[model samples]
Target: MPTVTPKTAGPDMSSPKTQILAALRRASWISGQALADAAGISRAAIWKHIHALRREGYTIQASSGRGYRLEHAPDHLSPEGVHAGLQTELLGRNLICRRSIDSTQNLAKSLGRQGAPEGTAVLAENQTQGRGRRGRSWASIPHGVAVSLILRPKTSPDKAPHFPLLAGTALARAVSRVCGIWPGLKWPNDLLISGRKVIGILAELEAEMDRISAIYLGIGLNINAEAEDIPPDLASVATSLRIQAGRKIDRLDLVRALLEELEAAYYAYRLQGFGPIREAWKEHNITLGRQVRISSGREIITGTAVDINEDGALRVRTEEQELVTVSAGDVQLCPAV
Candidate 1:
C-alpha cells in the first residue's frame, strides 16, 4: 500500500517524485518508457509506483493511446505535491499537514518544543480553533491557508520581535508574486490590502532574559473564503485574496511561493540580520505616515505613526512631541476625525 504522508510530514521529497511532477507539468501525458527513463526506474517498477499513486488518490489516466496523464489529483493535499511545488532547500524539509485541525500553531509549538529542526512547517486545510494575534479568532475554511513555522535561530532573544517583521516582508513578496497585487505591511505583522485586514501573523517566542531560543510564526491568510463564510463582525474589517483579486488561485502554487519566499528571507536574516528586509519593509509599510492609536498592554497611546525602531518596535510620536517605542501592542488605526 502507498504510504499516506502524515499531516506533519509535508511531501514525499524523493528526487524521483520531483522529476515525475515536473514532467507531468510540462506534458499532459508521457509514455511509461519515457517516465521510467526520467525517473530512472524500470518499466515494471514504474507500473508498480503508478498503481500505488492511484491507490493514494492520484488519478493517472493510463491507456495505450494516452500512455499516462494526471486526470485528478486526490482531494487530499499530499506532502509530495507540496514538496514538488516547493523547489527549495531546508525551509520545508520538515512538513506536517492535517486535513482538519484545531490549530496548526498549537501543533507547531508542540513540535518546536520537541526540537524540530529549522524550517519545520505545519499546515492545515481547516482549523477549528485558529487564533490570530492577541487571541483573535481566525477563520480556517476548507482550502484556506492556516500554517505555522518553527524557526530555531541563533539571534538575540531581544531581536526575536523582528521575526514577524521579516515574515511580513516575505508575505508581501509571496502575495505579490501570486496575486499580482501589492499588499502593505501594517506596523508589525499584519498584511493589509487597501486598508483592510487580509492576513494576520502571530509570532510566539520562547526564550529567557538574554538570548532567544525559538520562534513560532503562525500566519492566517484569507485565501478563498467566501464573503459569507466570514464572521458578521469582521465583514467590514476582513477581506479574502480571491475576493480582492476577483478569481480563484492554485493553493499549491501559493503555498510553494510562500515557503520559498520565507526561506530566502530567513536565510538573509540569520546571515546579515534584519537590515535589507527591514528597509524593504519600511518601503512597503502603510502605517508609518498614518495616525494610529496603539493599545500597549493596558495604557493606550495615540500618535502619528512615524517609523519602526531598529529593534522592530512600533514608534509613535504623540501630540506632546514624545516618541515611545512599543514592544508589543494591539494597533487600532484611528479614523479621520
Candidate 2:
C-alpha cells in the first residue's frame, strides 16, 4: 500500500459524545465519574451525552453498579464512527453525515462552489435522488455507503475524465483490505464480483477554460444489503458485500479504508503522475484483454479491449483490424460464440 504524510489529524473529535464513545470503546465498562473526568465534564453532562449516543443508534448497556458498556455500534455511517479510526491527511478531514438526502453529489458540488476545502466529504445513509453514469438512477438504501468527495486537483481539464478510474482503483483496494475479496474493475466506473456490479462511481468536474476547478467524486457501495434489498430488475446484475461475504460488514471500517486509499492514490497522481494509478488499475481491471462491445451513441463497436491510454481512453481492436479509441461509452463483455 502507498503512503502519504498527513498534513493534519483526521476528523474532528472534540465533542463530548465523541469523547464518551471513545472511552466506552477503550474498556469493557466505565464508571460515570470516570467518563466525566476523562471528558472534563460533570457526571450529569456525561449522562446526557450517553443518552444522545443511544439515540444515534449506539447500543450501550448500563449495569446496576458498572457504568456503561458499548455492546454494539450501528452499521450506519456517521462522522464520529468514520473518524474514530480514519487515517488520512486531506481526504475526509471535513466530514458531513446525513441520515437522508437527495444526493451527496449535489451537496458536495454546492459546497465546492462555495469554496469548501479540498478534503470535504459528504456522506448520506439514504440517497433519495442518487445518479449514475448515462443519466441512470442509483439506488442507495440504509446500511450502504453513499459519499461524495470534493477534490481540487491542480491538473488540466483533459485529465478530469480519469478521476473515475482513480476512484475505482482506490475503492477496489479498500474492499480487498476489508473483505479479503479482490473485486474486478470494469472500464469507466463499476466494480464487479462474480460478474455482478457491487460498486458504482461517478465523477463530475467543475472546470475553467484550461484548469480544473474541482471534481466531485460520488461513490455508492452496497455493503450490508440482502438479496431482497436489491431491486428485482437489477437482482441478476447487482450484489452487496454482505451477499458476497455471507456476513454483515462494518461500514465505518470500509469508509475509513476508502478515504485512506483515496488520499494515497490522489496524492500519488498529483505529485508523482498517473503511471502508478494506471498500472494499479490495469492489475485489477477485467476489461483489458477481453472481447468487449462498446455502445457509443448510435454506433455499437465489438472488438478486443487492447489497452487504456494515458488519458483513460479505451483502445479497441475491431474486427476490421482497425484500432479505435473510445472516450466514453457503455462496455459489455461479449461471450465467445
Candidate 3:
C-alpha cells in the first residue's frame, strides 16, 4: 500500500471541504443548506467538511441560525488554491498533491506509463529522494516546491535535451514575476538568485528509435527556506526566495504563475519551435559571455562561453580558438583571466 500523506491544500475541486473553502473565500455568510445544495451534499456532510476545513487551519465561524462564514484561510498550497488561480489550457489539468513523497518524477513516470494525459502534474511538499542532474540527490525542504510535469511531445529524441532548458527559462520568468527580482540562468537548467542556486530542473524521457513517448520534467525550487535550513555544505551556495527577498512567499501563487508560464512556453515550443525559447533563454542567461569550465566525464574543457546553437548545445571558444559544441556537461563559471 502507498503511504498515506496529509494534505494542507490540494487541487481536488470536487472535495466538499474544498468547495466549502472556495465558497468561504468570498468572505460572505453561506448557510448550511445553501452549501449543501451547491455541493450536492447533506447538511451533516457540510458540517463534516467544515470540521475538516478547520483542521486544515481555516478560521470558520459557525452558528445555529447564522450559518457559516470564513474568517481567514491558511496560506498553504492546496488543490483548491491551485485550481482557483490556475490560468492554463492544458498544464495542470490533472494534478496530484502529496505532503511527502519519494520523488514527483517517479510518480509522474508511473502515471505516464499508465496512460496519464499530457499536462498531468504531480506535486509534493517534501521529496525523500529528489534527484538532480547526473543522478545527484536533491535536498527539498518543507517550504520548497517539488513538481513534475508529464508531456508527450511529437518532437524527435534529439530535442529531448532542450526540454530542461525551456523549463529553466520558464522558471526564471516565474521566479522573477513572483519575487520581484530577475533570476539568471546557468547554462541548461539551474536558476541562480543573487549568484546562488535556487532552482534545479531535471528532464527524463522514454523513446523508441527516433520517436518519443513521454517526458517527465521535474523542478525543485527553494521558496521559503532560510540559510540555516540548508545543509552546511550548501549553506553558502544554496539560497531560497525567502532568504533572497527577505519575506515569505505564497507558494500557491508561485505555483500558479509557474504553471502558466511553463504551459505557455511548452505550447510555443511545440507550435513555434525553439526560436522564441532560445532568445528568451539568452536574455536571462548569465553564462554566455563568461569564462567557464565544463566537465564532461573524464574530459574537462576551459574556454569562453560564446553561444548556444539552435539545438540548445553550448558553444565554447577554447584557448586554441576552436569552437566546440557541448551537448551536456557540468558548467562552472571561472574568473576572467
Q: Best candidate per TM-score, number? A: 2
RMSD of each: 5.6, 2.5, 6.0
Stretches > 4 Å off in candidate 3:
1-48, 61-71
Tens-place lDDT per residue, model 3, 57-147, is: 8888988888898887676667766765466767886889888899999999999999999989998889999999999999886588899
lDDT of each: 0.79, 0.87, 0.84
TM-score of 1: 0.89
Instruction: Write candidate 1's Cα lDDT for 179-269 as tens digits.
Output: 9889999887899897788888999889877777788889887887777888788888888888888888667778888888887788787
lDDT of 2 by residue, 84-200 (tens): 646777788789999899999999999999999999999988999999998899988547989999999998999987799999899999999998898999998999998999999
The global Cα lDDT (0 to 1) of model 1 is 0.79
**TM-score per candidate, chains pooled:** 0.89, 0.90, 0.87
Better of 1 and 3 by lDDT: 3
Q: Whole-model lDDT for model 3 versus the true structure?
A: 0.84
Clashes of 1: 12
Give the TM-score ranking, best first.
Answer: 2, 1, 3
